[model samples]
Target: MSLTKIVPSKPIKLYCSIICPWAARTWIALTQANVEFEYIEIDLKNKPEWFLKEVNPGGKVPTLKYGDDYLIESAVTTEFVADLLPEAKLLPSDPFELAQSRLMADRFMEFVFPAFRKGLYQGDVAGLSAELFDGIEKFEPYLINAKPFFGGSDHPALAEILVAPFVSRLYLAIESGLVDSATSTKLATDPKYAYFNTWAKNLIASPGVVGTFDKTTNLEQIKERLAPK
Candidate 1:
């Protein structure tokens, strides 16, 4: 597997909101790829007409404008950027390894993300936290040999990039007392999750991961959204 340098033919612009985990995924990917681009922050509550009509008909953030072409959805946009900058090695070059990375990300998104969201928004913190732990238990074996990332790379891989945003949010939620302390302790100290704990700590400490995360503001918005209406 060889890496190819990415030379963008046109300017890149990223449409994103810091509060959105999905948008944060694309932001992290762009930074990891070392791609130069303009950042356009969107107000989700008051979405602009131009953004809706032109950028994304669905009015979603994390839209990528590559020259005149626009791409939506965080996963697709992240993969597009990774594919564009093969030299970054964000995604594995080998087909099998790349598929494994994608599979891990898919499983996290399908299992853990929903449970985490339910815990955050629905006030079922304890039950959902247990459910989340169960999901993580299932995911732990995949990381047995993964030193710092699921791709078995020293640096973050596509799987980490996809999941780190939510993990960061979970950290914030725990700090803010939105998630129970028992769950947090288990996640951090349990022998079963030692590998995942290390991977998560490294991911959170990574350059683009924390930089792209606005913990204070994002936590506030999450609380507001989860507040009784």
Candidate 2:
């Protein structure tokens, strides 16, 4: 298949941080769609004046500036980028598949993410690791029928793109001893989790997923965060 080359009126600019999972999702989708844009690194910790002005309402990362038009929120940004390339549709055409796919993303954000997100923030250290394993279990069965991907898709589908960043972080923590070895072990080895494990492997291998992620540095950061001072 020939690549689709778009002639934009001007280059699009993406304001994002490397570590933000939401930002990471947009980055992956953009890459998968073969869309080109200017990447503007934003220090989420220290918001720049220009960034604040650009994303005035949200002051958030993963903001897309196309010509003079601006968009916020990772999901919206991803959808906007997808629209740019009509040939590379991210969501499926089947209504049932689209709804189910969206449902999986919703499950991860509402149920799986919150369960572990607070634990990671609280510096529960151990709890942060444990909560993720619980979330993985919830995801495992759902992925049981997947073809090395979420929703049994043959390719790295939307759900994989959205969740890979967080999973990558946990996988790193496990290797560095920041997370419990047993939990990571279960996530990787448990038969019940075969679906997620295989799909995760594929997601981990995706160029888009790896391009924005820095596991080694992120591990060191998490370790420093949990260190007993």
Model 2 per-residue lDDT tens digits across residues 49-149 = 87776465578878988888888888888777766765666666677877777777777776567645654445576676556657767755445346766
| Model 1 residue 151 lDDT score | 58
Report each candidate's C-alpha RMSD, comma-separated, in the order given.
3.1, 2.6
Q: What's the lDDT for residue 186 in model 1? A: 82
The lDDT of each candidate is: 0.80, 0.69
| Top lDDT prediction, candidate number | 1
Error of 1 at 47 (Å): 0.9
lDDT accuracy of residue 213 in candidate 2: 81
Which whole-number lDDT from 0 to 100 does residue 129 have in model 1?
Answer: 77
